[model samples]
Target: MVTKVVLNGVAIQAEEFEEEVIRQNGVPLHKIRFAFKVRSNEYHDIATLLYEKTFDVSVPEKDLNFRGTIQNYSTSVTNLYKENEVADYRLELVETN
Candidate 1:
């Protein structure tokens, strides 16, 4: 139930957050999914950050930090180039091995 997530040093207010530990070949990995909103003014910065693919992910409430890559991503609005627009974004990140 993490309420905030820090990605590459940028703090994001998460509307929803979920974390899971999954084992692959008996090795544990952290996977997190979170949702947030992006305003028109923030679209550029958020897009640039996500486009980087990999991140230093942090969840203070969970005391979690890891170098992760994007596992899934989605946005509610595709046309966020205009002013006064807001988009809902969902992202999933998995810890790098």
Candidate 2:
């Protein structure tokens, strides 16, 4: 379970997390992409903050902690009358130069 995405001193309560490494010619690269989400009521407050073109981002999880910048982001709302309480987000980031 994802806990939060911290950026620029603000923490966003996230519900999901995904991390991927980009490689070229079987060699490792310094760039990384991360996706995270926020469910329930806090979605509206923190949704916009995750999409900054360039900002310090920190993802502290049970297994690993990633810190980088906001390369990109997208959000999805369940919108179901019964399950209208969920917000999903996907984020991309690259290592700071």
Candidate 3:
């Protein structure tokens, strides 16, 4: 299990992030989701992670550290501009090695 997400040099809070491994189109990838309440004004500079295209992920429980590229980016728009948006940030990372 992923215990922390460190992008650049910032440590994103665990409460706002979720991590898992899953197969998409028969390819294995690390899936990370960021679900922050609309109230928290903390922007972890998600754009940088997307633009940089790579990050170091820590799975503390497993004592693993690896770097991967952002293979996919997506968001969930509950109602577009008409309503509050939630669950709207996600990333799919494929290990280069």
Of the candidates shown, which would achieve the greatest TM-score relative to the real structure? 1
Question: What local lDDT score does residue 30 receive in model 2, on the 0 to 100 scale?
Answer: 41
Reference-based TM-score, model 3: 0.52
**lDDT tens per residue, model 1, 27-81:** 8999999899999999999999999999999999889999999999999998789
Residue by residue across 1-97, what tens digits does model 3's lDDT show?
Answer: 2245565565544445556777767776666655332211333355444578877766465464667777776656433333433345566565655
Clash count, one per candidate: 0, 0, 0
Model 1 global lDDT (CA atoms, 0 to 1): 0.93
Q: TM-score for every candidate vs. truth?
A: 0.94, 0.51, 0.52
Model 1 TM-score, all chains together: 0.94
Pairs that collide, model 2: none
Where does model 3 exceed 4 Å of error?
Answer: 14-40, 77-87
The lDDT per prediction is 0.93, 0.57, 0.55
For candidate 3, what is the total of clashing residue pairs? 0
Write the candidate numbers in order of decreasing TM-score.
1, 3, 2
